[model samples]
Target: MKHLYTILFLLTGLLSATVSQTRPDKINVILMGSTHFGQEGFYKQGPSMDLFSPGRQKEIADINKQLAQYRPDMILIEREPSEQHTVDSLYNLYTSGKLQFAQLSYGRAEQYQFGYTLAKQLNLPQVYGVDFYSSLPTRLMRDGKNLDKFIEDLNKFSNLGRSFDQQLKDGQLSLKQYLLKLNAPETLQATYYNIYINPARVTDGSFGKADKTVDTARIDKSHIGAEYISLFYNRELKIYSNLLSLQQAHQSKRILLIMGQRHAAVLSKILEDNPDFNLVPLSSYLK
Candidate 1:
């Protein structure tokens, strides 16, 4: 009888542990959009801009406020994975208190400086650039290595840059828009060629030995300038899957994904197919 009682107690303990491990903790993914125009009044006077303007400071403050509220375990950016070194350098500067910004007008230097500041203030662990880098040869390949194609590519990039600049002026573009634009179909294709294909050609040392090949089938299914959209969707799904797995493994932490406004629609649709996951909108926090 004593031996039987001991065996029963051991079985009960094992059952309780198994049940605890199988249960999942709620995972929250929040996708917040930010205004890249920085804070209002960040720039003052004719054609001159202050990188550290008051408005920019305010924008950072707002972001910081949100960070405090969310206390995210990780923050992901739309940076290219190849730019990891640059990312690491920025991270070190931020965490070591060696990062600082100066007042300036017009250009990427200011924007990047500000990004560094925000990442630092939040004490973010690692910043992941989920996008691919653009390459020159890839551009040539996509455009059929012709002058006309080159010109068209240039025009597109120029136009996008202008549109984004205009949005900054109008205060209409959010951080989400700024990031998504880089991964836009045309932009993504151009970038993929630049990073992936161009390098392959360079190694072969054949700049323009043969005619550019177009995969009509792939284009048909994905469409021109939309392949990156599909890639983004795919990546998001993988991220979601990883989050789910993590939840199951720990059964104690929740996940929140901060994504662009464009993703909200598709992500919601995708989640519908996956019954195990739940999709909650930012609106939940708004009210």
Candidate 2:
């Protein structure tokens, strides 16, 4: 009888492990590209511009149609984790019908801010932000006071130059085109690597003991291609880690992530490396 009891316990442990390893129903993700809903140039926009332009409204409707079909268990956004309170407040305002604007302003702040509202409307779980925000002190440390001043000055200049609608439209530019327009040379790649890796080491006070044998010289190029590539790679790793955690926590539920278009390629590549995840692009539903 004791021997039989031991056998039963072993079988139970094995069954639990098997259940943990099993995949959920289906995880669907969408990497959406915004176009300011066909708004004008970027330099002239104000805070009061329409949030959901007509084109954007149609897009959201179409996406909603997809959501209804997919019926995902959760929706995740690309917002900073620290902005949860602001997002929650905005969502409340939206669902309460207190947030109103033109019909065509669907992609505006008011519109983008409606992500939580949409999640609620779909009757899905609360939306989550998968990224972290840098604190003010950290930002100041990473970027000098001059850099902060420059960003402030740039924002002021931009606001004075163009309509808010235009600014939204500008954000729609593809990653490649945007980088090229910035005139970032290949050499900037090394600079970015140093910035990213050195900070962690410095902050941890482990710079003296960290591995310095690997030569990053070859990867540092002037077109800044390496930097761009690294950024995307890091982003993919972050998403993968989060998805893995979500998978472990909710063994039976599906998770849907909404991110920018630039991340699609890198994420697709990363997914290819992990056989457990079956990734389905949003484009598949459009047809």
lDDT of each: 0.44, 0.45
Model 1, 218-257: lDDT tens digits are 4422232343233344555664554454456544232344
Candidate 1: list runs displaced more than 4 Å: 1-24, 33-52, 101-119, 132-214, 221-280, 283-287
Q: Which tens-of-lDDT digit does each residue in 220-282 have in candidate 2? A: 333232332344355557766766665666662555565543344345556546666655544
Best by lDDT: 2
Most TM-score-accurate candidate: 2
Residue 273 of candidate 2: its Cα lDDT? 62
How displaced is residue 266 in candidate 1, in Å? 3.4
Local error of candidate 1 at residue 149 (angstroms)? 25
Candidate 1, 84: how far from true, in Å? 3.2
TM-score of each: 0.45, 0.49
